[model samples]
Target chain A: MAEKRKIDARGSFCPGPLMELIAGIKAANVGDELEVLSTDRGSAADIPEWIKKVGHELLTTTEENGVWHITVRKTK
Target chain B: MKIVIVGGGMGGTILGNNLARRLHHELRTGKVRITMLSASDRHMYQPGLLYVAVGSMMPDELYRDQAGLLEPGIVFHVDPVENFMLDKRQVKTKSGAVHDYDVLVIATGSRAVMDSIPGLAENAETFYTEESAVRMLKRLRGFQGGRVVITVGVPHKCPMAPLEITFMLHDFFKERGIGDKVQLHYTYPIGRVHSLENVAKWAAPEFDRLGITYETLFNMKEVDGKTKTLTSEEGSSCKFDLLIAIPAHKGMEVVEKNGLGQNGWIPTNRTRLNMEGQENVFVLGDTTNLPISKAGSTAHFEAEALGENIAAMVKVGSPVRDYDGKVFCFIEAGKDRATYAMFNYTTPPDPKAPTRAVHWFKVAYNKLYWASARGLL
Candidate 1:
């Protein structure tokens, strides 16, 4: 099983959360799962698009308590 | 009634979206037709450029399709306006098409005139447009920990941007472990660091806390790009490793070409937002020579009153609404904290100290702004 890392980018703006997710993915091992929590609603839409563009596998996305949680898995 | 709006910038788009939604009935009945003329199809959320400069945001995220933001009843034209024939109530486009209008809204906004100061165009990095912001980001990433000077040119839009960059650079350098090696300086042409007295008072100590040298009333006269030095009109000189300047701004070229501007900016009635001596024409945002900060919040506030006034003008043939020159600015102190100031023509801004809550609000506002462009917020 791949290791899971969490990045709490809540209260951060657009691209803030996305940038944090990218940095987190860079530090994680291949096949590791990374989750980003963001309060900026645009992240829900932006992160998924970015993950697809970068050739990463998106696991799931959910919203709870006005915050969005986006999870991705590093494929390479 | 034909309403023609020039310049699909923040002010023009907001006014057009509001007016279109408010006049949907008249538009459906063919009693009103709205046309928007924009130089390009891109609508930029300018506030996001600050984050782009700091590498927190991407440049592509700051832009949206201009045509997508308008309602179905409005016509979006991607053509540069060549001339404004105000006397004949017509606007001429670069394609040689003349658009006649019963009501004209001029929101052409301002443009950065880097050539105003010698050597500035070749030397400094500005965070105003997407291309400029990307260039600034590249320059910032390659900085090697020396003096970074940020100057606020006179009558520049978003007066707080230089301050925000100052604070963000402090955090950025610290994060890079070069905070002790880098020195930050902020200079403005005004008598104080900020035009609002209370805001200046509140910011002075914060600048000191951040170890930023704040120089006021220092008007830029020349820049030597080869030597990497800047000279003030008073003969004072400063050397810098990198120059980040809020370049000199002026009203759009079409406005000046048509002789509709005084001192390079359109003069408007401060309260009515109408062009001087032209009752059927209106001006808003940075294009107006109003004694107010040319920030996005100013455009947002002006849109509120202008929308009401335009609605009344279309419905009853006269405007009854008045503007109070309200402006709100969220000042980012660092990556985690921000402060806000709210004021109007009669009241000076009493700025609060930095707080995490305001930072979150500013973050959320960036997302909410898209909804606002679609006339949903």
Candidate 2:
């Protein structure tokens, strides 16, 4: 039951947001949720795909204030 | 103050964004006008193009529209540059449009030369263009099994590209269960696999691990597609089923015609990226005569310093900013792992510096450096 971590990755190009999410996942414990904030349109699609492929759990994905906030939980 | 940057490649865009973010306030005083010119609507992440050609990344994923990445208040010119009037401080576009600038930056990058080898153009496929990358990717995917030769042409971008191709070929063959059938060979004009030792050391073991053949100090002279042979300058020959040739590099036609390129590249200071003769003009990225690999990371790092320098020059009319000739690269060796290197030409490292640390640092930089360039850091 740790506090969720947030990373701002707006204006970053591809592999940037995913890399930050991976880094964040690495620093968190199992069941820890992480939120990635990005402006890149591709991230909305790419992050969920990466999360599924890597065995991470997607918590929620929402767009607000001209940015997409993707939350993923460390599954393993 | 008016800032005009020509050529919307890696150098121009990075410098444009960096300047816009830093000098947004100065422009409110009517002291800054930054303009970027290029014909293409898409921003090609060129470094990933090589992987795209190898089927690692999809074509659409490697390219992004210029409109989305650019910031507000910066004018994007969707026209090709027809000519440059240096004395008049103007650039003429293809449609006869003229742009006047107080400070002009030339970031038109270099191009691959295919005419050097006679049969290369006819037989081999280059990964420079998106179309060519798609073609190469198709060829790689359909390749059943064959003797493939990967050779580095002279003065190519990302000097380690050929090595990376060879390493990935090994991985590709392994994954396809044809590792024993496809004989992979890597050839370089220089004795070392890479121009820099930081990358060459990691590549040496990977080559050994993957059992890829390598020939050094051999300059490729001709490719006889009929006979499936590659002839070298020393009159030696190697046979292959497929040829991946990295051709020689040449500056853009504009740089050559304007007398900017003397030794085949625009002469600029090693650190400042300022043109050797013109006071108002600056150049950076792979288009200059600096003794460094013409890679995106170099352009990215140089852009930060160059952009700041341009802003300072426009605001205070001074030239005081400095640049550290630092470049970081990540060599994807396949199998979900990479090798990275961070090289700084200033204060050459002692020969005793741990090569493994340099290698690991390079691997770790793959993610960190990519993020930093995207403005996430």
Instruction: Please write out the lDDT profile of model 2 over residues B277-340, one tens digit for every residue.
Output: 8888888788876656688877888888888887777668675667767776666666355555
lDDT per residue for candidate 1 within B191-234, as digits (tens), equals 45665557778787888988899776566778998899998754
What Cα-based lDDT does every candidate model obtain?
0.81, 0.73
Fnat, model 2, is 0.00
- Candidate 1 on A1-76: residue-level lDDT in tens? 7898777665432114664565356446889999888766667876787676557899999999988989999987
Candidate No. with top TM-score? 1
The best candidate by lDDT is 1
Residue B128 displacement in candidate 1 (angstroms): 1.3
Q: What is the DockQ of each candidate?
A: 0.01, 0.01
Give lDDT for model 2. Answer: 0.73
